[model samples]
Target: MTIGLDMMGGDFAPLEAVKGLQLYLSEPGAPANIFLLGDEAILRPLLATHMIPEDRIRVVHAPEVIGMHEHPTKALKEKQQSSIAVGFYLLSQGKIDAFISAGNTGAMLVGAHYSLKTIEGVMRPTISTIIPREDGRTGLLLDVGLNADCKPEHLNQFAVLGSLYARHILGIQQPRVGLINIGEEEGKGNILAQASYPLLKENNRIHFIGNVEGRDVLADKADVMVCEGFTGNIILKLAESFYEMTHRHSIRHEYLDRFNFEHYGGTPVLGINKPVIIGHGISRAPAFKNMLKLAAKMVKSDLFDQMQIAFRN
Candidate 1:
């Protein structure tokens, strides 16, 4: 399998990406041939300096790059030669099994939507983050920032999507689904929560466990938390800050280390036809390596096929 890497996307471009490739190559059973997408003039020297094995990889020179602040739609349309655009082109044409990037997130999402097909029966493709639970197990949270406003049916579908992801990617079987809400009772919370409760409870596709309050997120009360992007993003950001704040104060602990985004690498734009992993803009070597690992796992697992079958049923 060939996995495309956006060598120009992250804050520390080609450099960190090269270093990450080194890390990935050193590991045993590292699957997928790396496809580097960026300026050939710059990438060639860097790859040589880093002593990257040429036979294990291929470089697709993309002369342009989409700036982080550029408008997603506009940058993609105007910068046809940009790394992100070319990466999408390769993916759409089946040249790459999956694509990984830490660049303009808006551009990545926009490209995925337009360039790839959505699974049949999926209302909207959602993005999810891995939630580190207090009990040492991990959970999944969906619609973190995509589809900020969603219908009750959207939340219901997210439950199914999140559950399937947890099972296939996170290695959780019969993953319990929960709706993020203000209360634990079935009829509690906002209009969206209240309306979504019955649907989740009724949905046979997932193992629904009723509502999970804000405090229940990290407690392992649920394996898949479903919510609209507005609330899910807030929870995601707040959790992210815990790691940042702890490091700022010189607090160290194994538990806090789990909050580091590098450990998980990045989140996949779930529900899409092909695997597209988006990394943190500030991602370094470790994060990039993990992203490659994730893309490989997703492909080897035939994740999208399982998702398509689930949705079709």
Candidate 2:
């Protein structure tokens, strides 16, 4: 499998991205070939410095770069030669099995939507974060920052998507799906939640548990938590702050350390035709390495094919 990396996307740009490639290469049994997308002049020297095997790495020169603050749709349209755009083009053309970037997230989303498009039955594509549970196990949360506003049908689909990801990517079997709400009781949330509960319950594709309250997010109450992007994004940001707060106070603990976004590398834009991972803007070398690892797993799992089958059935 070939995985594409946007060498110029993140805040650190080519340097950190090249460092990430070094880290990934150093790992034992690292799967998939890497296609680095960026300026050839910069990347070539970095690759030589890092000693990445030429056979395992391919460089695609894209001189243009979409800035972090640029509008997603506009940048993609105007900057056809940009790294992000080139990455998407390669992905759409099947030259790469997955595309990853720590740079402009909006551009990645816009590229995925317009270039590869969504799965046939998917109403809208969703992005999800890996939730580090209080226990040793991990969970999945969906619509983290995509589709802030959603319908009941959208939540139901998110449950399916999140569940498949949990099972295939996260190695959770029969992952339990939960609707995030204010209370655990059945009729407890707004119209969306109330409307979504039955769909989740009746859907045989996933193991749907009852409503999961805020307190349950860190616990094992649910393996896959589904919510609109607005609530999920708030929860995500709040969770991120916990790690920052702990660092500020110089408190070190195993559980708290799991909150580091770098550990997971990036969040994958689920429901797209191909795997597209969006890394944090401030992602460093370790984060990039993890993103590639995750991308490799997603491609190996045939995740999008599974989604198409699930949605079709």
Candidate 3:
């Protein structure tokens, strides 16, 4: 399998991306062939300086880059030669199995929607973050920042999507699904929560465990937490800050380390026809390595095929 990487997407640009390649290639039985998308003039020297194996990778020179602050739609349309644009183009044409980028997230999302098809029964594709549980196990939370405003049906669909991810990617069988809400009881919380409760409970595609409050997020009460992006995004930001603030103060702990976003590499856009992993803007070598590992697993496991089957039913 050939995987594409946007070498110009992150804050550290080509350097960190090249280092990430070094890390991945150093591993025993490296996962897949890599396609580096960026300026050839800059990437070639770094690849040589870093001693990256030329046989395992190919470089696709993209002379342009999309800035973090640029509008997603406009940048993609105007910067046809940008790394992000070219990566998506390769993915759409089946030249690559998956795409990874730590760059402009808006551009990544826009590109995925336009370049790839959503699963047949999926209403919308969602992004999810890994939740580090207190019990040493991990969970999944969906629509983290994708759909801020969602209807009851959207949450219901997210439940199915999140469950599939947890099962295939996280290796959790019969994953328990939970609705993020203000209270544990039925008919509690906002109109969306109330309306979504029955739908989740009735969805046979997932194993629903009723409502899970904010406290349950870290308690391992649920394996797959479902909510609209607005609430989920707040939870995600809060979790991220916990790590940042604690690390900044020199607080050290194993649990705190688990909160680091680099450990998981990046978030993959679910419900799309192909795998597209989005990394943190500050991702480094470790994050990039893990992202490639994730992409390999997703492609090998036939995860999307299972998702298509589940949604069709």
Candidate 4:
């Protein structure tokens, strides 16, 4: 399987992307077929300087890069040679089976959604990435920024989609789905969360665990956590901050290594017609390459078609 990576999409650009690529290569059983998309003029020397094998990696020269400051829609429309844009086009054309980008999040979202389109009947695509929890098990959070507002039906579909992801990726047959809310009680949330609970419960497509509070996210009450993009993003930010703050005292300790968000690589923009994974803009080479392995794993596991049917039902 081929994973097309946008080398110029993030804060560190090609350098950090090279780190992630190294991680992917070092991983046992990782895919070696990678298409690096960015300016070859700068990248070639970096590869030479690092003594990275030229035969194992391929470079697709893309001149322009979609800057973080550029509007997503406008850049996607006008920047034909943009790294992210061209990488996504390669994804659509099947020259590359999956795509990994650490560039502009908004541009990645916009490009992936419209370029690949959503699965039939999916209103908005989501970013589902695995997060380390306190209880030794990880959790899945969706709509991390894909849709600010969601209806009962959309949340219900997210539940199904997330469950399928958990099952396939986490290897859970009956992954519990939770609706994020202010309280766990029935009808204890805002109009959106309250309304989503009933539909989630009624849906036989997934195993709904009713409502779970943001505090329970790290506690591992449910395997697949569901919330609107606005709420989910806030929760993710807070959890990340808390994790880092709590680990501040043990920064030098090897035994007490805190969970690093970078270790999980990137979040796949779920529901896209093809696999499109988005890494943190600040991602270095290690995280970037793991994101490529993830896309390979997704294609290998057939999560796209599985989710397409899971929600279709």
- Look at candidate 4 and tell me the lDDT of residue 5: 88
Q: Can you write out model 2's per-residue Cα lDDT over 101-149, one digit (the tens) per residue?
A: 9989999999999889788899999999998888878899999989999
Candidate 2: segments with Cα more than 4 A from true spot:
none
Candidate 4 Cα lDDT to native: 0.81
Alpha-carbon shift of residue 103 in model 1 (angstroms): 0.1
Candidate 3 lDDT over 219-271, as tens digits, reads: 97999999999999999889889888999999999867888867888999999
Report how far off residue 134 is in candidate 3 (Å). Answer: 1.3
Please say which candidate is ahead in lDDT: 2 or 3: 3
Could you tell me which residue pairs clash in candidate 1?
none
Clashes of 3: 0
TM-score, prediction 1: 0.98
TM-score of 2: 0.98
Q: Mark the 10 consecutive residues where model 1 has the least summed lDDT.
A: 254-263
Q: Write the per-residue lDDT of candidate 1 for residues 283-309, one digit (tens) a residue.
A: 999999999999999999857888999
In order, the Cα lDDT scores of the candidates are 0.92, 0.92, 0.93, 0.81
Top-lDDT candidate index: 3
**Could you tell me the lDDT of residue 135 within candidate 1?**
92
Candidates 1 and 4 compared: the better one by lDDT is 1
Clashing pairs in 2: 9-103
